[model samples]
Target chain A: MNMHKYEKWWMLFGSGTLLIFLIVVGVSAFYMGSTPPYCATTLDPENVREHDSFQELGLKQLDDNEYSLTILASAFDYDVGNPEKVIEIPKGASVSIYATTTDVIHGFEIAGTNANMMLEPGYVSTNRYTFKNAGEYTLLCNEYCGVGHHLMAATIKVVE
Target chain B: MSKVEQREQTTDPHEDVDLKGTLFGVAIVGFFILFSWFGVWALFLSR
Candidate 1:
């Protein structure tokens, strides 16, 4: 088909840019492991308090320099083993955090860190992070659940 | 044919459009896309 020279160049430029974007996304998601959160595990929200993991929530050392932190999000509260308690872990330790919400949807975000996940009722969300330095990181709920949303926060203390 | 009719017949619609301006706009958009994508890679994905 007969086409203008400018039209041809524009078509080529558009398609090339689109191809580059797709390639970058594919590489980042597959090769570099920059993927969206996945939660196939489900449980009864009502029984979360009784569940073994939630019953004994908070940090547990699994191995040398490795730990697991289980958290339960409820109405305007984040229960890290005990409510209003600061979760403490050793610096330079790898922590795998598992969280679920019992009341409404909440956000699990460790301020000034890459640990962020959305906690929904009945579904378990998880994130793995390593704290390399000793500091106190604030854990805040980014999702608006109720009037006390502003008060829904906790502290993560990475001790040396 | 008259002079006016002859002039009209010779004019091309595509020639009237500014190709350089269009190309410049496309380049600007492409630049923003690349900048944003690389920013995400450097900040979020590179770790």
Candidate 2:
């Protein structure tokens, strides 16, 4: 076959680029444990209010600089347990957010942050994020549950 | 010119075409894809 030199080089370049992309994603998925959002942990939605963690939906210190924030997404509100719809934490603190819905599926997304999950009625979705900067981040529900979905939001205040 | 002389003087059209411009354009596109991919990848890893 008579192939031009430029065509041969172009094929190499294109194939090489694709190979690198596949290797990167493959390594991250298989070894580093980076994966897409999914539903694995589950519980009884009917009795969620009585569950150990669900009993108190708020932030709890787990370690020196680590914390766990339990949240319940109802019809159109997120109960972070606190009267104020805000989660205040020190900068650089690692917070594991466990979110679950009481009625329908809702999107748990923290604006400007990578903390996003899908909260299902009987399934528990969780995400961990360390707030490195001091700012007030918005927590909006990306999923439309009902007429009040637009009003569903929370606040994540990271203080330095 | 004679028919045989004219036929021999004709050159291959493809041989005269310069691929440098196409190469440069493709190189730009490839780098753009790579840089944007890294930007997203870095964001995902950093957060």
Candidate 3:
């Protein structure tokens, strides 16, 4: 009988790598589902800041009745997109969003929070998000047009 | 047929294999699957 060379090595290496990846993914999925996704934006004062918990999207209590945020995207580079900068609307009122790219097409999406919107070059897309309960939401650039696409990310804070 | 020709026909030399193509195809497929899975997870899950 002829023995197979490197068969065991290939099998073990492939299966091991796949198993590790799946395990990491399984853990992350559970954690993400447990915690409400936080919304982040590029218009942050500091580079990064953390919010205690989820609040309403837009409210006057945070000291502003309305807010306007402008972001720039050129070719493949993009300015930051901060969800906290997105005004938190009052309990019953709506928070308006006006977003556009400077050069290329990009999508602005808030995952799991009904904040799905898009942004295009030279044109602003405006939408409103209303929140009754307080929770953190995640904001992400849902478009892939460049090398730094993965690095384009931020969060939105909704505080009561 | 000559005796030498009959002996050469009966003996085996080696198996021909397209290792480079097999490796390249496997690498491309594996990378695509791995990155796509990671990209989706990072995009959707990393909140």
Best by DockQ: 1
Instruction: Give each candidate's fraction of reference contacts reproduced.
Output: 0.19, 0.19, 0.00
Q: Give one digit per residue, the lDDT tens place, for model 2 in A63-142.
A: 99999999999989999888789988899998888889889989999888888888889988877778988999988999
Candidate 1, after superposition: displacement of residue A49 in Å?
Answer: 1.0
Task: Name the candidate, 2 or 3, with the larger lDDT value.
Answer: 2
By TM-score, the candidates rank as 1, 2, 3
Which whole-number lDDT from 0 to 100 does residue A147 have in model 2? 95
Ranking by DockQ: 1, 2, 3
Docking class of 1: acceptable
Model 2 spans > 4 angstroms off: A26-36, B1-29
List clash counts for every candidate, in order: 0, 0, 28
Pairs that collide, model 1 = none
TM-score of chain B of 1: 0.56
Error of 1 at B29 (Å): 1.8
lDDT of each: 0.84, 0.86, 0.52
| lDDT leaderboard ranking | 2, 1, 3
Cα deviation of A19 in candidate 3 (Å)?
49
lDDT of 1 by residue, B1-47 (tens): 66765344555677677788878887788788878977876766433
Point out the higher-scoring one by DockQ: 1 or 2.
1
lDDT string for model 1 (A36-111, tens) is 6667788998889887778778999999988999888888788887756699989999888889999899998988
